[model samples]
Target: MIAAVRVRGRTGVKKGIQDTMSMLKLTRINHLVLLHEDPTYKGMLVKAKDYITWGEIDEETITQIITKRGKLSGNVNVTEEYIKENTDFSSIEELAKAVVAGEATVEDAGIKPVFRLHPPRKGYEATKQSFKEGGSLGNRGNINELVAKMI
Candidate 1:
């Protein structure tokens, strides 16, 4: 799955970019959303590249995010019991695998689509620049380390 995190706030942002971020479910800074790597999402990512960072995420990182930050409806934390009771998966790891393989989604496992993440421990690089320029925006090839810091 592709992981996208909103790094910047809405101040002075264009209506079009704000709408794109909203559609991606990245409505606030440090919020995360996992999406399939499809053309539609790619286009949205490109359009909102100045305000968010995205990259391919591995199963391990996904598992960590779910265990540490995943939440269900009514503000409950996601547990193995919840997964077993609500979805076909018996555990969070299985659910993560299914999600990565595109067989399921976090919502399918009863977790909320949006993950509220803490800011990276040491903070972002340069919010105004792209990842290629050592900033925190745009596509970042592997975001495991960044997600690790946030979690």
Candidate 2:
């Protein structure tokens, strides 16, 4: 799965970009969404590249995010028991693996689709520039480090 994090706020953003970010479910800074790496999602990522950072995520990082930040309805934390009771997975690790493999989704695992992450521990770099330019925006290649800091 591809992980996308909104790094910038909505101030002075174009309405069309805001709408695209909304469609991606990245409505706030530090919010995260896992999406399939398909053409449609890729297009949306490109469209909102100026305000968000995205990259391929691994199973280990995904598991950590789910364990630490994944939430259920009514603000409950996700646990192995919850996964067993509400979904086919026996553990969060398994669910994360399934998600990374495109065999399952956060919703299918009974977790909220959006992950409300803490801002990175040390804060972001230049939010107005791309990752290639040593800033926090645009595709990040491997997003594990950034996600780790936030988690």
Candidate 3:
């Protein structure tokens, strides 16, 4: 007689943290930072080992996330204002440009990964009707021509 027991547990479930990272469907986890205008803005950069949301680096979001997670190490202003404080970023495009140049962190620094959306492969030409219907002397012609090149 053979008897066996299977054991499984919630070993992989991460607790109490979520962000835009999940939207990325990331193949790899890399660093993300929020930049600032003044050299002083770098002070608010929050480091996350996992995914994070689309929060402005100017204030609050970083503070709350970093404070709650305790995964990042650095000083935070502890203020509860982001959108209001970051009013300068009028549009998502403006926000993105700043992030690219490293002038802001979505607040102080604009550091984010470059996302290039690539189109998927068109897939194989699954049907062979074109080859088959090359008119009249088709099927044998394909085999004979291939062999003729050898001769």
Global lDDT of each candidate? 0.93, 0.93, 0.27
lDDT of 3 by residue, 9-73 (tens): 12342442222223222223222223333423222111212222122232322333323321211
lDDT by residue for model 1 (1-151), tens: 8999999998999999999999999999999999998999999999999999999999999999999999988999988888888789888999999999999999877789999999899889999999999899999999888999999
**Per-residue accuracy of model 2 over 74-104 as CA lDDT, tens digit each:** 9999888888887988889999889999999
Instruction: Write out the backbone clash pairs for model 2.
Output: none
What TM-score quantifies how close candidate 2 is to the native fold? 0.97
In angstroms, how far off is 60's CA in candidate 2? 0.6
Name the 10 consecutive residues with the lowest summed lDDT in model 3: 1-10
* Model number with the top lDDT: 1
- On TM-score, the candidate that comes out on top is 1
Candidate 2, residue 25: lDDT: 92
Native-referenced Cα lDDT, model 2: 0.93
